[model samples]
Target: MRLLLISNSTMAGEEYLDYPKNNIKDFLGDKPVKALFIPYAGVTVSFDEYEAKVKAKFNEVGHDIVSIHHFEDPVKAVEEAEAIVVGGGSTWNMLHLVHKNNLTEAIRKRVISENVPYIGWSAGSNLACPTIKTTNDMPIIDPLGFDALNLIPFQINPHYLDKNPDGHGGETREDRINEFMVVNTDMYVAGLREGSMFLVENGKINLIGKLNCRIFKNNVQAYELSPKDDFNFLLK
Candidate 1:
């Protein structure tokens, strides 16, 4: 199975996952590609509309777009897909949707049993983490308990920013990430900037992106990766 976790929407628009389409060939070996997008977490587009747009985005990226499905009936979608890509958005909102649709176990089972390639960005990346304790977005709503699919043992704060120049200056993204680490020492935190990705191929973890991926343990900097770094601990 292969898992691609991006920090955010690829290039910042509705076609947010274009970069992965170009680079995914590097990891797929010779297997044919089939992808699914879960847009339940996004606030803007309806899942059906997002599905249509994602297909176009896939074509724009030059991949043979097999199908683009929504999250309402994800199990059926997974059954028909060889790969799955969940788009970026609010982590809390996504988790709420996941719980609402009861898709956690279904997705995990497919990834673990069927070896389906799983791809996600931002909120999707956060879902791969142990829990959703490091998102920098305002807590507009809470699902009571912020949890995740635990695909990786560590906690991941995707799209991590060191500074937000909006003038609020309340707290840097790094500071919020650090706050999450204070109570969860057993879990590692990956502070990924935009364009960053964590890939799991054949169950191996590879850090792929343009920026350094900051690793934190006990609220301390454990290490950083510029690009194509191996983070097998996440897979372990």
Candidate 2:
């Protein structure tokens, strides 16, 4: 199983995917690959519009993508795909559609068995965990169940922030994650900061950006790990 799980798509003041275009290019390699894109998470935008936006960026990086919406049989599409790229939006909507289409197992089989490359950001990253219960998105829709792709053993709180905005007395991101830890005691959750990502290939994992990834567990105090640190333990 290979995954490039990004924290967020765009950085502040930058164009869409500009920060990770090179990373995506390098991951896909010099040989151009027309990846299969899953665009159901894009609720605010039409699937076609989302596809065009992402397609443009992939093309710029010497890779290409065709949205799965264009296919009649989504399962067959996943089976034939060389690569899978899931874009960020509403986690609920994304998983809802995945369940509705009965694609959960199909995708897992293809990526794990065939070693097909899988890339995702934001909500897409959330889908790679054992379950989507750690997602920060509102429950706009029932995802049928909380179970996700389970491509990775741990959960990822993408676009993770250290604190709440100015003047707000609401609970910080850490507080919420602490709440999750209270119940899912044995699981690991990585607070993946913006502009950073996790690269998991074979059985090894590595952090790919300059930002330090925050780690959280039930009883352990939360701490930061830089890109230089080994993240392989999270896989266990």
Candidate 3:
């Protein structure tokens, strides 16, 4: 399986997808591919608006994208796609539509069997995990099931922060994750900070950013892994 799972889209004061655009270019290669885009996670904006924004960014990087909604058969679209791109928004909404449209298996098959490239950010990254149980998104609605595409064995808490903002009395991100660990003791959860991403290909995985990824597991002390360290362990 091949995947580029990003933590977040835009960085502070930067253009949409600016920080990762070059990395995206490298991943897709110079041949240029018109990727199939899944934009169902976008609840506040129209699919067209979301598609346009992502399309503009992809085009700038010598690639192109078309929203899955454009096709009548979403499953068939995934089957024929050379690459798949999932945009970030609401994790619940995205999985709901993905399950509603019955594209979960199709997506998994395409990426795993066909070796089609997969790129996702934020909630999109959450979609690639064994389950969306670790997602930070509020449960605005039911997703039909917590099961996701399960392209990756581990869980990713995208946009993970080390602490709550000053004056905020809410629980820290780690606290919530600790709660998850208590129940799912065997599973691994990676705190993927903003601007960082995971690159998986040919059964190997690598971290792509300056920041170190925070790792959490039950009974094990949380630790940090930098880009220089091997992330292949997560794949197993």
Candidate 4:
């Protein structure tokens, strides 16, 4: 299986996908690929608009994409897709539509079984985990089930932060994961901060970006790991 799970698409003041465009280009390689894009996570933006924004970035990097919405048979689209790309938005909406379309298994077969490259960011990244329970998105819509694609064994908390905004008394990100660990004791959760991502290929995983990813597991002290650190342990 091959996956590029990004924490977030854009930085505070950066252009949309500007930081990862080159990483995307390198991941897809020199040969231009017409990736099949899943834009179901989009809520406020129309599918066309979402596709256009992503297409512009891929086009800039010598690749292109076609939104899955244009297909008559979504399952068939996944089966024949050269590569799969999922954009950021509300994970709830994305999984809702994914279950609604009966695409959960189809996607798993293509990416996990068939080795097609899979790329996702934010909510999209959350869908790659065993369950969407770790997502930061509100339950604006029922995801049909908490279970997700399960492409990776562990959970990813995207846009993870060390501290809450000033004066905000809400639980820190770590506190929530601690709550999750109390019940799901064996699971691992990676606090993927902004500008960081994980690259999984051939069953090995690597962290990408300058920032250290905070690792959390029950009964173990949560700690930070730099990009140079071996992340393959997470796959175990």
Candidate 5:
């Protein structure tokens, strides 16, 4: 299986997808691919607008994408897609639509069994995990099920922050993750900081970008891992 799970789409003071455009280009290779884009997570923006923005970025990198909403049979679209790209927004709405369209299994089979390259950021990245329990978004709508694509064995907390803002008397991100660990003791959760991402291909996993990823597991102290360190252990 091949996956490019990004922590977030944009960095502060940067254009949308500006930081990862080259990474996306490199991952797609010299050959241009017209990947099928999943824009279900979008709520505030229309699918046409979302696809246009993403299409512009991919076009800048010599690739292109067509949103799945344009297709009548979404499953067939997934089956015939050369690559799949999922954009970030509301994970709840995304999963709700995905389940409503019966796309979970089709996507799973396409990426896991057929070796299609899968790229996702933020909420899209969350869908790559075993469940969306690690998402930072509020539960605005029912996701129908907590389960996600399960493309990766571990969970990813995207846009992970080290501390809460000043004067905020709420649980820190770590505290919430600690609560999650109490029940899901067997799973591993990676606090994927902004501007960071994980690359998984051919049974090996690597961390990208400068920021270190914070790892959490039950009974073990949460730790930081730099890009130079081996992340393949998380695959197990």
Candidate 6:
């Protein structure tokens, strides 16, 4: 999959269009962009206004925008799309909606078959894992199924190392991911610092950002990165 996976909304050294979008802009490089911003829990914007805003973003980037919602025809959406950007939300909820709308396969086909790039940030990144069972957020309700798109074999716990004054929480993001690693022995974890991203070029995974990245195997620190490099080990 030509996936642009970002850790969070903040881009590297900038606060404009979120981390993932920055990666996308680089990969697209003047190519037309069409996005599908998966809706929030109870948003009330009409389709026309949504389309207008989408058009605006595309126009700002000199791309085209084709607006589609979870409630609409996903097949048509994927077909018309040259590139797709999935926004952040509840992982369980978004996966359920994807399955409910029978969009998982169609989206995969678009990315894998049609060669369209798929950009996901936050919960969108979570959905690209093999399964969503290990996410830090409580799965409020069981989805149609928790199976991920499996774009990448490994699981990514984005937004790692949040700085908080009070250190009290049920479990740290790393802790939760460790719990999953204990059971799933094969998958590697990429601890993406905020503003960092995983870029898929020619079906290879590479690290892009201005920060160091940590690699985890069975929750143990494997290595750290400060230089710009492509992670072929993860791809293998």
Score every model by TM-score. 0.84, 0.99, 0.99, 0.99, 0.99, 0.83
Candidate 6 per-residue C-alpha lDDT over 68-93 given as tens digits, one digit per residue, 9 for 90 to 100: 56435776777777777665557777
User: How well does model 3 score by local distance difference test?
Assistant: 0.95
Candidate 1 Cα deviation (angstroms), residue 192: 0.7
RMSD to native for every prediction? Answer: 2.9, 0.6, 0.6, 0.7, 0.6, 3.2
Error of 4 at 43 (Å): 0.3
lDDT of 2 at 197: 94
* Model 2 agreement with the true structure over 52-161: per-residue lDDT tens digits: 99999999988999999999999999999989999999999999999999999999998899899999999999999999988888999999999999999999999999
lDDT of each: 0.70, 0.95, 0.95, 0.95, 0.97, 0.69
Better structure of 2 and 6 per lDDT: 2
Give the poorly placed runs of model 2, Cα more than 4 Å off: none
Collision count of model 6 = 0
Candidate 4, lDDT over the whole model: 0.95
What does candidate 4's lDDT look like per residue over 146-167, in tens digits?
Answer: 8999999999999999999999
lDDT of 3 by residue, 119-222 (tens): 99999999999999999989998999999999999999999999999999999999999999999999999999999999999899999999999999999999
In Å, residue 190's CA in model 5 sits off its true spot by: 0.3
Task: Give model 2's TM-score versus the native structure.
Answer: 0.99
Span of ten consecutive residues with least summed lDDT in model 1: 63-72
Clashes of each: 1, 0, 0, 0, 0, 0
> Could you tell me which residue pairs clash in candidate 5?
none
Instruction: Name the weakest run of 10 consecutive residues (lDDT summed) in model 2.
Output: 201-210
